[model samples]
Target: MSALVNMAAEVPENPLVPPIPELVIGLVAFFIVFGFLAKKLLPNINNVLDQRREQIEGGIEKAEALQAEAQQVLEDYRSQLADARHEAARLRQEAQEQGATLIAEMRAEGQRQREEIIAAGHAQIEADRKQAAQSLRQDVGKLATELAGKLVGESLEDHARQSRTIDRFLDELEAKAASDSTKAEAGR
Candidate 1:
């Protein structure tokens, strides 16, 4: 050992190599700093990292849950919209059916009114024709009685006799007209 010490002292000091004492002191300082970081700063940093990772995972889960809820809400809205559209269509169809029914009712009412008006018109015309015929018959009877009186050169003034003669003459004329119409129909 003494010989080794003497040999080391005689050796030239290399510029690159640290002296032994300085190396020892530097090594000791490095150990103290490493220990402090491992015991205190390293644990705190790891804990912070763990907290951050947990927060990120929680945030992601919350986002996924919110997205699922939003999707459900969207589905509900869409279903409601579809139902509303269906209801609207049904209402529109019902309205159209009601409109068609109303139109049909109106048309039927118009037809009924038209038939009534035509019947009323025919009845009025028949009444007017009968009145005219009765007036003309009276005039004809009066004229025939005056002519008969003139041709016979006498009054023949009795109400019952005049009525009977007029009635008999009109009846014979009606029979002739009826016979003529029947004969014409038979010919056709």
Candidate 2:
């Protein structure tokens, strides 16, 4: 009975639990590995993370600066465009003014030339009329003198006497014609 009780009491310990020695050795190895990783790899990982953070921040700053520069350039370009538009408008207005002035000057010159031509034409007509009237009067006077000499049966060869006779005859005829026109008007 004693031997059986001792065998039962010496039965294998619980299978769920590890031996003490192995547990102790495993804990030591785990501590050593954990310490080495914490000391050696943790700082390196932190340094890499910090470097990545700095790079991201630098990239953001650079992008912001570029955006600001782009904005400035856009503003400058807009200003230059406005100035160019203003200059173009001014030039167009000036050109229009000059064109209008030139047209006015040309119109004035044309008007002056037209007036001068009209005056010259009127003078030329007056001169021609006077010349024609003088020619007709001379021809009439010559015919009258020839007729008078035939009627009188005497040669009126004196030029001064012939002129005086023609003048007297023309004055009497004009007076008679005037009296006849007046009488006709009164009868109407």
Candidate 3:
């Protein structure tokens, strides 16, 4: 046991510190790894960072361009809408004017037709009155001839004389009626 204790105490001169050769070898290995990373891996990382930055900037520029195009399209749509509205208004106004013109023409045609109808009616009434007067004259002449034949005890068969007597009687009757109407107007 004493021998074993002496060997363990002699094996390590200082327990807190490593041997010099081992420390030197470890420091050299660490420097070799750091140099390899700086030479090869660092440049690759820098290239990736630069590529990502460029992509982000391009995306922003593209988004801005798209936004501008959208704004232009919106403006064009608004302009077209305004033009359409104006055209619609103009068409409406034109339609109204045409409608008014049509109405006027129709009204004038109706008035003309009314006047023609009234004129035709007046002409028909005049013709009917003349026909009735002629018929009445014939009837009265016949009755008068019959009465005269009965009173004088002879036939009134002379056509020309009978016509002249009837015409004279009608003239005298018309004159008497006109004078009576005039006297009535004066009295009123």
By lDDT, the best candidate is 1
Listed in order, each prediction's TM-score against the native is: 0.75, 0.65, 0.78
CA RMSD, predictions in order? 4.2, 5.6, 4.5
Error of 2 at 163 (Å): 3.6
184, model 3: CA deviation in Å? 3.5
Please provide, for model 1 over 54-162, each residue's C-alpha lDDT reduced to its tens digit, 9 standing for 90 to 100: 9999999999999999999999999999999999999999999999999999999999999999999999999999999999899988987888889989885898888
By TM-score rank, best first, the candidates go: 3, 1, 2
lDDT winner, 1 or 3: 1
lDDT of 2 by residue, 1-188 (tens): 99999998899788899989999999999999999999999999999999999999999999999999999999999999999999999999999999999999999999999999999999999999889877876888899989989999899989999989988887898799999999999999
lDDT tens digits, residue span 70-169, model 3: 9999999999999999999999999999999999999999999999999999999999999999999899888887887899898879999888877887
Model 3 has an lDDT value of: 0.92
lDDT of 3 at 87: 100
Name the lDDT value of residue 85 in candidate 3: 100
Evaluation by lDDT, superior candidate among 2 and 3: 2
